[model samples]
Structures are given as C-alpha cells and as structure tokens.
Target chain A: MKKNRIFNTITLLSASVIVFIVLAALLFTGIIDEYNGQLLTLAGIYIIVSLSLNLITGFTGQLSLGQAGFMSIGAYSSAIAMMNFHLPLVVSIIIGGLVTAVFGLLIGFPTLRLRGDYLAITTLGFGEIIRVIMVNLETYTGGAAGLKGIPSFSDTGDFLKDSIIKFSWVYVFVIITIVIVNNLINSSPGRAIVSIREDEIAANSMGINVSYYKIFSFTMSAFLAGIGGALYAVYFGYLNPVMFWFLTSVNFVVIVVLGGMGSITGTILAGVGFTYIQEWLRFFKDFRLVIFGLALIIVMLFWPRGLMGTNEFSIVKFVRKYIRKEHEGGSSKPSKIKGVK
Target chain B: MSVMEAKSISIVFGGLKAVTNFDLKLGKGELVGLIGPNGAGKTTVFNMLTGVYSPTSGDIVLNTSREGHNYKSIIKLKPYQITQSGVARTFQNIRLFKDLSVLDNVRIAFHFNVKYNALQGILRTTAFYNEEDEITEKARDLLKIFNLQDKEKELAKNLPYGEQRKLEITRALATNPKVLLLDEPAAGMNPQETHDLMNLISFIRNKFDLTILLIEHDMSLVMGICERIVVLDYGQTIAVGTPEQISKDPKVIKAYLGEGV
Candidate 1:
C-alpha cells in the first residue's frame, strides 16, 4: 500500500510538470500568442485568489468578504517595492505577500472570533475600509487617480520573450499555490481546520485548537490573495482603487460557490472557467453584471452544492475504473446477452 | 487513585442554580454512572468537568498525566486544554463530522497527538508522514475493533444509527484519553445494540485502563456495567452508592417519581 501511494504521488507530480513544460514551451514559441497569454495569466491570478478564499471559506468554513482588500494591499505594496526601491521583481512580489499577511493577521484575530454572517459583514467592511484608505493615501499609493507607469514583466525588450516571462511567473506561482493548498488540506493541521468547521464544540472537546486553526487558515489565505494581487500589478502595469471593488470580491466568492465548497479541483476549474466566460461576455459591455447575476442564480437553482459537491476530480480513479470495465467486458457482455435471451 | 476529582463544583445560569455543589471522583479504570431526571443537572455537571462551563464555585482537578499523578486544577483551563490534559468526550447528539469519512473521523480525533507543525505538514516532511501514518494505522485499528473497518471510507452520516453511535465512541477513544466522558451513550439504541455497547464500554475501560463517567437514561446497562452510581436531583447529589444501594434509595425514588410509593 505504501509503495502504491509513493508511485501514485510520483506519477501525479511528473504528469503536472510535463503539462506545465508543454504549455510554457508553447507560450515561449509564440504559438499561444500575446492576447491568449494575457487571458490565461488573468485566469491564473484569479485561481490563486480563489484558492486563497477556498482555504478560509471552503475548508475553514469561515465566510470572508474582504479578500479583495488583501489583494489591493499586495498590489500597492509590490508596486512600491519595484518602482520606489528598485528591488528585484521576485522580492517585491514576496514583499507584497508578507505585508499583506501582516494585515491579514491583524484583521483575522479580531474578526475570526465572529462566525457566519457576522464574520462576512466584518470582512466586507474591512475590504471597504482598505479601499477607502487606498483612495486617501494619495502620495504613497497614487490614490484613486490610479498608479501608472509601474514596472511590468516587459524587461527583456523582446515582446515574445516578455510575454513568456510574465506567463511563466504566473504559471509558476499558480503551481506553487496549488501545491501549498493541496498539501495543507491533506495534513493534520488541515484536519483540525476542517474539524472546527464541522463542529466547533466537538472539535474543542476532541483537543483541537479551534481559534488558532481559524487564524492560521485566515493568515494563509491572506498571503495567497496578496500573491495574486502582486501578480495582477505586474501584469497590468496599472492599478486603480476602482479595480479592487466589492464586486471584484464577489466575483471570487461566486467562483468558489459555483465550484464545490472544499473541493480544490472544483475551485480551480470554476476560477479558470468563470474568467474566460467573463471575458467572452465583455461584448455585453456595461450590462455584464446582469449576465453574471443571472448565471449565478440559475446555477444555484439547479445545483446548490456547486459543481463537484466536495468530491475531488481524480484522474487515477477514473483511469482505474475504465481499465476495470475493459477487463470485465467479456464476462459481463456474455451474462447480459444470456439474461436477454 | 482518582483520575479526576471535582471538589464542591457548582454553576449558576442567570438566577437559576443549574448545578449546585456537585462533586465527583473517578477512580482509576472505574466506570461510573450519572443519572437523574431530565434537566436535573446531569449534563451540567458534565459541562463543569469538561471545562465547557466554569463552576461558579469549587475546583476541577485532573490528574493531567497517564500515571495518575501531576494533578492540576483544570477548571480555569480552556476546553481544548482540558482535553489535552487527558479528558475526552462524545456529544449527546453524536457530533461526528458528517461530511468526513468514518476513518477520517477517528484520524481527526487523533490530531492532539500530532507533533508536526504546519510547515512540515505543507512540505510533507518525513516527520509529518511518520506521525500521519501512525495516526492512520491507529485509527484503522480502532475502527476494526468497533467492527466498522469495512465502512471506513464511507461518510460518517451514511452509517446506520447504532453504528454511528459506535463510531462516536470510536472517535473519542482515538484520543487515547485517560478519562472519557460519554453524554448519554445509549440514548437511542435498541436492547441488543445497548447490550453490545455495554460490553464494548466495559471492554474498552479495561483495555485502555480508562476512568469513565457516563450519563445515561438506560437503567439496565448503567446498573449492569457501572461500578458506582451517582444520582443527582435539582443540581445536587442526592445519592452515591453501588447499583444495588442506588435502586433502594428513597431520595432517588422521590426524584424519579413524585411522592409516596
């Protein structure tokens, strides 16, 4: 059994790496093109933040409506690091995540004590407060007028190389984020977090630190959201207070809800799927929100548990089932024919 | 030799004296029963012992170790800390993590024993896998003992009613606690299941060397397995004796009924 587990792990990792290399090769070769690369990077960044939200809301069972606030903090912090201090782009991105993590801890400690709707409202208020602060801090942040002429991934001067470079950064971060989230959910600390969401009282009596795990999940989520924000800043080379609005926060939550809560694979699919759908719906111009709203309502009405319903998409399981069916085909077919006769 | 002791513990909710001057001493490897009419503070005493509710007066001193030494006042400690200090409980309503698998339920309860940090867990360090593998091995052993090994991968809520109750006990025992508090363990079982549960309780008590405090309305099972019976009435200890002595006590009769009989 242990050998099988090790084999499965190796296969999964190698498969993911191979797929990444193939895609990166395509991007570098210019076959994916700049426009499609931009779209994929956007989808990748959104997945990072959605995974962050999933860590808190889906796994930890805490409703947080202030994720966009953390994202904005990352965006501004990383932008300042790169433009002002001339720090390396990597360091600046990390700085964004670290600074935003501090804020996550600050807000999480006070707000995590509240549960359900109260926590949601507190987070919503916190996001608005961050946006307000960004709008007011005109000198440091460039305020509501927006920060422009920021350093982007176009350092190589060659358009093809630059697009690949930026896409690689996003893709690498996406893989890193996925690994961290996946590993965290399958471990002991992850079990503790989920148990808190299951039954706080039962979790407590069973010797799980409910509050500490809640804060831990919250902080991890904030860090990831910050990373997503940093990626956004470098990708667009521009920022505005209007960009990280309440509606932006709602978009991520909608993806999480459309995916199954607590299903990591489901959230990734929904994040990437919803991003493309939104981009396509841009033809509707200003009424895109109406379309999104209707889509959400219809989805919830049809499948309230979301796409996966807490069941993960496992390639190994599907392949095994398919193989077993093929092996049983001869005997099963004869039995079915005999019964029919 | 008492693993857990409550010295004149009392708790009040608003103006009502929910449980007044209650006391209990659970000896090593002994099974005790707490019985009372509905709302007679049986569960309130449980709440006080488990650190769910702070006693308005008195102290709850737990041994805090497996060797029946290192007694400490657990009254001021948080519920999780008290649990770590060697007490574990199962809820009356069977609070299993419904969405999680049966094996996952037991493994989660074993979380207190996990020594790896979050970074190690995320990194999949050797130490993390070692501890996690140990937990899985132990959890499987526990489920096998409860005869639910076949359904370990099934969601907890999908289990039959009797098995769900068994799974709850299985989860509590996974903590490897010195003291186990069962809140109405036999609340919703048939005679056969309750009989099996009675045997299971006694079997585990001996196997784990555990001191048990069970609150139950099942008279036969309680009288059959418990070494001592503590009867409560209106937030007070009305009687404390063997099953034979408790059955013949007039105060207990008065509490269970109205008057002359």
Candidate 2:
C-alpha cells in the first residue's frame, strides 16, 4: 500500500512537471512568434477541428470523413453573416456553429444508423457535396475566388511591465476550446460516448438511447469544427473555396489517429506536434502525405487501440487506493502529530 | 389488470413464423416460466414482448404507474423507449460491456434516469458530482445485494461464468423495470449454481417488486421456482397452467417429455 501510494504520487508529479515544462517552453521562448496572426488562427482552428474529430472517430467509434465540409459550412456562414448582415464577431461565430450543427444533424440522422464503413462513406460524400456547393454558389461564397477582405478579429499580444503577461488571443481560444473538450470527454456524457463506441449492442441493452447519443456526438463534434472554421476565417482576414477541400478532412483524421484515438491529451499533443512537424518538414513537402500515411498505418499495426488505448488516467482512484493500502498494513501505534493515529 | 399484457402477438422471420399468436400476461410480483424444446420459439416470444422485434399483428400494453395513469402501448415504442416504460430484458447469450468495470456496467444502465446536463457534466458542477455520488451509492447497494461488492473494479470479461451472468442480471435490474425478462439464464450452470440462481431470482423479485418472465430449457429449475408455466412447441402455445397441470398435459408430454409419457 505504501509503495502504491508513493508510485501514484510520483506519477502525478511527473505529469505536472511535463505539462509545466512544455507550456513554459512555448510561452517564454517566443517560438510561436514566427507565424503571422493568420497562421496562428488557422492553427487554433485546426485544434478545434482535430479535437472534434477525435471525439467522434476516436471516442465514439464512429468513422467520419466529413469534417472539412462542416468546417466549410461554418466558414461560409460566418463570412455571409459578416459580409451581408454585418453582425458582430461573437454572434457570427455562434451562428456559424449553430448552422453547422444543424447540417450535422441532417446528415447524422440517417447515416448514424448504418455501420462504421457506411457512415464513413456517407460523411465523405457529404464533404464532397459541400465543396461542390461552395464552388457553385458564386454569389455568397465567392465561387472560385472565395470571400476576401474579411475583418481581423484577434491580434497578437499586449505586454504590461517587467512580467511577461502574453495574451495571445489565438492561444487563449485554443486553450479554452481544449479545456471544454477535455472536460466533456471526462464527464458522464463522455462516458456514454465511450460506452457506445465500445459496444453498441451492449449499450442498447443497457437502455442507452444509442441513436440519440450517436447523433448528439456527431452534432457536437461538427459544431466545434464549425467554430474552428469561423475562428480561422476571422483570424486570416480572408477566405477561399479551395481551402475547404477533401484533403483537409483527411488531414484531421490523420491527426486524430496519430495523436491517439479517444484521448483528449493525445489529440492536443498530436495537433501541436504535427503542426510543427508539417512546418519543419516543409522542405520535404512531397513526403508530407507519405510520412503521415505511414505513421497512421504503423501506429494502428503496433497499437491498434491508439496511444492511450481505453485506459483513462484517474488521479483520484489512484490516490484512494494508495491511501487505503498504506493504512491497511502500516503500524497502528498512535502518532505524535496532531490528529494522527 | 395485469401489469403487462401481450395479446395475440405473431412474429414471422421470412415466412418461418417464429411465433404464432403467442399470448402471455404478468401481474405484479408474479414469476412466470416459459419452457420449450429446441426451436420452440420461447425466446421469440420474449423478443416480441421486449420490443426487440415488433409483432406482425398484436399489441403490448404496459401499466407504467400503480394508478395506471401512465399506461403506454409498448408495441409502438422502440426498444430503448420500451425500457423507459418500465420493461427490461436480458439476452440468450450473456451480453455485457466486457471492457468496462462491473460498477460502470450497472451505472451505464442507469443513464435514462440520472438527471444532469451536458454542461454540468463538462463543468464538473455540484449537481454532476451529487448525481454521480447517488448513482454510485445505488449501484453499490445493488452489488451488495448480489454479493459482488468486492469485484466492483474488475472488468466484466474477467469474471467467472456465473458471476458474468449475475452481472448481466444486475445490469438489467439497474434499469428499474416493472417487468424483467430473462433468456436461458441457466444454460451453463451446475445444479448448485442453478439452485442459487433460483433463490436469487425469488429474492430479487420480492425485493424489487418485479414481474419476471423467464425462458429456460431446464425443466426442473422452471418447475421449482416458477409460479406459473407456459409451454410452446414450434412457435405455438401448447399449454399454460400450474406445474402439475403442465407436467400432465399429453401434448406437452408428446412435445417435450416424450420419455415420461
């Protein structure tokens, strides 16, 4: 018991150290300064998109290849809101998410009833349909040229005195999105999602409305992707129809798989990790697709369950087990410290 | 009125007619047995009653409240909705979330009743934790009832065969159904385990105030515990009566107990 408690404590402390070191390196070294505000926004947007993809394909065990299409809906909706209705930035983004969520529901209602491969094909078709519509709708979406001169929504930073208080709005947005997704994946609904993924037949017998939960997972995932798209549009100050391509959706899928399916931490880590890799390996741009494909295949072959697999780390369970074991066999002599026995 | 009534139900699987004009009724706290030979459609009848397969022509009416104010036509409801209307069922084969812990297996079945918002869950709000605690307490109490409290953390797949079957029943009971269905629950049990299962079923029925309908091939187990018995042969009801009447029926004797006859 004593050994287990000490081991758990050490694990937690090491995790905290790793998190602290990474965050400090990102903020203190000004490594992200190289990217323009637009690139940063796109990165943030991909963070939401990739995380949402992880929630569906990773946690829910439902394959989806239509994220790019959902993101396009958000991009076009926000662009139209700003260009036509002249709405504020926040309202437009919210509306964008709502519109995309509705579209998600429309597609999910029918396709979610089918099995994994069928759902994947249906989503892939949906993504292609959205792109085709964008190319055809020259009036609102700018056709081939796409919408331009969109106003910038967020800026880089504002420093105070000796202390460096960097509020990169892009990073802040990404952090908040990550936190929300993290919390959701760890909550009751998250458990439901994971349960459905693990065994649909068992989930149904347990009285979990399988269809309802599946649709909800799909809609929520698309909603986040839409938000990411809107953020990208606003940050970049421009938009184009070509941006929302089928390859973009595939990229998100690769990100989820590489990071580890059904893992919030792994998704975030992979998102940033791949983004840096993509940039660093830009010289070998032709090898980008090759390396990404190989990585996915290798990971699946070696660890078919992904990096974290199905085991979620729980600090509280570890702590309780440790404390119970320590008290089980230890000496029962009264201690000198206050309230000790 | 009976708590559950299945009137003139028929189910056909590609002209095979798996169940033909099958009828079963259950009053509160009644434990009924359905027995038949191989391919006798005892499970088909259970499936029709549970809404897993809708009848070709019939109706299932469930009295959801003591006053009957919340009555529903379960024939029109989906399987999950039927569960919410106070009907739960087990499978012929043990179907469990094999990867999940035993406690989670039960708690997940309690999802329909546990009230908390997605927002509250994401925020880890007080209501979330409170509801979680309540669910844990109730699940633990249920485990204690089945003497499975010590194995709460173990995965469902790691449990012994009898324990796995018990866990499946525990999961079904977690839904708090007014009527529970069991399919071939004693398929692989020894005599000792069979006796224990019989006692557990009786104890659970009285404790939960549940009306149970069980399909089993074990004639002795069925005759021992069931208050009433229904016999089926080739998707048709051959007899329905007490143990004595069923044991003596010539048609049932010909269909299932030819050696004795």
Candidate 3:
C-alpha cells in the first residue's frame, strides 16, 4: 500500500511538473507568433472534436460520422450569442454545448436504436442536413457569406505586454479535456462504453441499458464537439457555411482511425500531428487530402488498431521494464510484435 | 407469497404461436427448472418475465414489495427497470463484454446504483471519489465471490468458456436481483463442467439468497438442482410438479418419448 501510494504521488507530481514545464515553454517560445499561436489554439479545438468522435466511434463501437454537425451547432449557437446578444464568451460556450447536447439527444432518440450500418447512414444524413441548413438559413446565419467578427478571446498578446497568450486557455481546456476523458475511460462508466463497443448484445444481457447508454454516449460526444466548436469560433474569429461540410466530418473520423480509435491520448496526439502535418503540406495543399485518405487506408490495413492501439504508453511500464532489465542484464526493448502491448 | 406470477401468457408470431397459454408461479426462495426440447419457448418465457416481449394476452405480476421503499411491478417494465424491480437474467449464448475486464463487466452492471453525476465524475470530487472507491471495492468483492479476483484485470473474452459462463452469472447477480433467471445454463458445457455448474448455481442461490428460475436441456442437472420442474413443449406447460412426479407424468413422458407414454 505504501509503495502504491508513493507510485501514485510520483505519477501525479511528474504529470504536474510536465504540465508546468510545457506552459512555461509556451510562455517563453518567442518564435511562435500570434498567427502560429492561433493555429495551436485551433489544434486544441480540433483535439476536443476528435476526442468526442472517439467516444462514439472508438469507445461505443458506433460508427458516427456526424461530429462536424454537432460542432457546427455549437459554433453557430455560441458564435451567434456572442455576436448578436453580446453574451460572455464562457456563457456562450456553455449555451453552445447545451444546445448541441439537446440536438444530439433529439437525433439519438429514434435513430441510435437502429443497428450498425443503419445508424452510420442515419448520422451521415444528419451531418448533411446540418450543412444544408447552415447554407440555406441566410437570415439568421448569414448563409454562405458566413458570420464574422467573432470575439478574439483566444488570441495571444505580445509577449512584452506581460499578458499570457489567451492561447493558453485553449491549451488548458484541451489538456484538461484529455485528462478527464482518460480518467473517464478508466472509470466504470467508461468501461461500460467499451463493453458496448466490444459487443452490444453482451452488454445488454449484463444489465447495461444498451439503448440508453448508446444515446447517452452520443449526447456526451456531441456535447464535447460543441465545446470544441465554440472554442474554434473564439480562436478563429470567423466562420463560414463551408466549414461544416460533410467531408470535414469524414476527416475527423479519419483522424480518429489513424490515431487509434479508443485511445484518448492517442487522439490528442494525432489531432496535433495531423493538423500540423496538413498545415505544413500547404504548398501541395491540393494533394493534402489525398495523403490524408492514404494515411487512413494504410493505418487500417497495416495497423488495424492504429498507431498506439488502445493502450497508453506510460512511464510506469517503462520503469517496470527497466527494473526487469537491470535484473536480467538485457536491453529493455521488447519485440515489435510484443511491443504492441 | 409468489414473487413472480405469470397467467395465460401467449405470444403469436405471424401464423405460429411462439408461446401459448404458459402459466408459471415462482415463490420466494424457490429454485424452479424449466426444460423443453429445441424451440420450446423456454427463452420466450424468460423474455416475457424480463419485459423483453410483452405477452399478446395474459398478465405477468412480479411483486417487488420486499421492503416497500418504492416498489414497482415487473410486468410491462423496461428491461433495466425489470432489473431494478429485482429480476435479472442471463442469455443462453454466454453474452459478455469481450474487450472490458471481467471486473469491469460486473462493475458497469452496478452503474444503476451509482449516485454520481457527470460533473462529479469530471471533477473527480469527494462524492465522486467516494462513490468510485466504493464501486471498486464492491466490484472486487463480487469478483472474489465468483473466484475471479485474480483475473479481475483480464478481459472478459480472454477467460475460458466455462469461466465466461460464470462471469455472465456474476454480472447478472451484481444487479442484486431478488429473482435470477438462468437460460440454458448448461448449454455448452461438458459433463463435468455441467456438474460443477450445477453446484455453482445452487451455491450462488444460497449465498446470494436468490430465487432462481432456470431453463436447461440437461434434465439431470436441472433435476438435481431444482426442487420443482416445469416441463414445456410447443410453448404449453405439459407438466408442473416435483422432479419425481415430473419424471412419471404421462403427458411429460409423451412430450419427451413421443407416444411411448
């Protein structure tokens, strides 16, 4: 018990230490201009969106291709509230999340009861509907012209001004989200979601209200997506009807699949990696999507469980391996096949 | 008083009467056996009792007024609601969450009793931690009861077939049901496994103070564990009596022996 407590304390201390260092580095990284900082903020937004999709498609074993739709709901709702009613940014974000959650429940009530492929198709239809509506509702939404002058709450100020980059808000939110999601998946309810993903009929017989939990998962996922969308509006200070197209929803799925569907940290890592990779390949931006398509196909074929599978790489495991290695006098590296653990 | 009473329960699917005029009564603390040939509607009876399918006609009254904090009838209740009403059941096909750990398989089933909200969960507040610790301890206790404590971290799919069957039962019992239903509990077991499973069932019933209603094809196992047996063929109860009486009943003999009676 003492050993376990020490291990836990050390883990917590190290995690905090790592977070503090990262924040300090961000504060000192003068090379990162306001523009680059904003991009990082966008990554944080996408991180939330990607992780939310992971809940339904990754953990719940439901094929949901409609996260972009939920994000749009959040974006529009939060953006409109701030732009029109002049609501506080935090309140707008909350409203966005709530609105998206209600809409999620509305869609989930009837459609989530359907089995596999049917649900996928239904959610896909919802995504299309959201896009079409955003495009058509010219009076309220400004239609294809898009909404603008979103509050620039996510912008980083000049370092000389003694103002920490508001970009840290995005980073903090994303990191907290990652931690919470990880903890949730490690918790009992999270395990239930995984069980449902593994086998729905089995989950049901185990006294899991399969339908209720499925819808619950969808609702929570949409809630997170809405939160991300709200952050996106704040960070980008602009929005367009085309931002929530069906393809964007598909792209989020691609990101999750390539990252390892059920891994929270893996999703965050892939969100940052994929976003930066796409931005960096902007010179050949036309081919950017082709590469994205290729990455997903290859990941599915070669590493069907994706880059990290569902297991997190932790220092605890490393320490264990190191101890074993010291006793045995062998290198700590496992075989590639065994390393999948 | 009987805990679960079903009267004239009938279900027809298109031209076929899948279950017809089946009557059953399970008293408190009774272990009842339901046996029949293939497609004898043994599972259909379980389904009706658990509210998976409402009977086309007839009534199912499952009185859940043991203490009367807030008692509700199981008849026409949702499947989960039936669980809350103290009726829990296992499927014939050994349904289990393959990816989740065995302990989690049972823990998640206990979510009905968890009193924490999403905020508490996200924040990992005092109430959340308290509830979580209690849940973990309870889940571990349950795994120990099933002799699966060592395998708590192992995924459900990794366990052997017989162990998986036990885990399914463990998951069911986690709901704290007053009455438990075991559908074809010995379906895929070998003879020795079936014998041990029979012992396990009786042991669990005694330990958990459960009223068990079991459907099985293994007549010997059911006959050994159950004090009373209900024989059904073509969705109709051919006989209902003690095992000794059921073995000698002319109608049951005819149902099994095909006119040899």
lDDT of 3 by residue, A44-83 (tens): 7888999889988899888887889999999999999998
TM-score of each: 0.94, 0.86, 0.89
Which residues of candidate 3, in runs, are more than 4 Å off?
A1-17, A23-27, A30-39, A154-166, A201-207, A314-341, B67-73
> What DockQ, between 0 and 1, does each candidate earn?
0.53, 0.44, 0.31
Candidate 2 residue pairs in clash (backbone atoms < 3 Å): none
Q: Looking at model 2 chain A, which ten-residue stretch has the lowest summed lDDT?
A: A332-341
Model 2: lDDT equals 0.77
Q: How does chain B score by TM in each prediction?
A: 0.97, 0.96, 0.95
Task: Name the 10 consecutive residues with the lowest summed lDDT in model 1 chain B.
Answer: B62-71
* Model 3: fnat (fraction of native contacts): 0.42
- Report the lDDT tens digits of candidate 3 across residue range B1-261: 788888888998888898999988888789999988778889999989888888898888776776443334456767777787788888888778777778778887888788876566666556766676687788789888779999987988899988898888888988889899998888788999999898888888889888899998898897798999998899988889999999888888888778844
Deviating ranges (above 4 Å) for candidate 1: A25-33, A316-341
Tens-digit lDDT track of model 1 for A1-341:
35445544654666567767787788887788787878888988999999999999999899989999999999999999998899988999999999999988888787546989999999999999999999999988899899997898778788777877887889889878987887788888888989987888989988898878888888899999999999999999999989999989998999898988888888888988898889899999988979988998999999899997787876544443565555432431100000000
How should the candidates be ordered by lDDT, best one leading? 1, 3, 2
Which digits, one per residue and each the tens of the lDDT, describe model 2 over residues A1-341? 23543454465555445644564455457654535322444555677899889888987888999899999898889878988999998789888888999998888797556778898888988999999999899988888887887765533344221112222444555655665676676556766777898787667766788888888888888888888888777766677767878888998987787767876656666676667767776787899768767767887899776665555445434444576565444532110010000
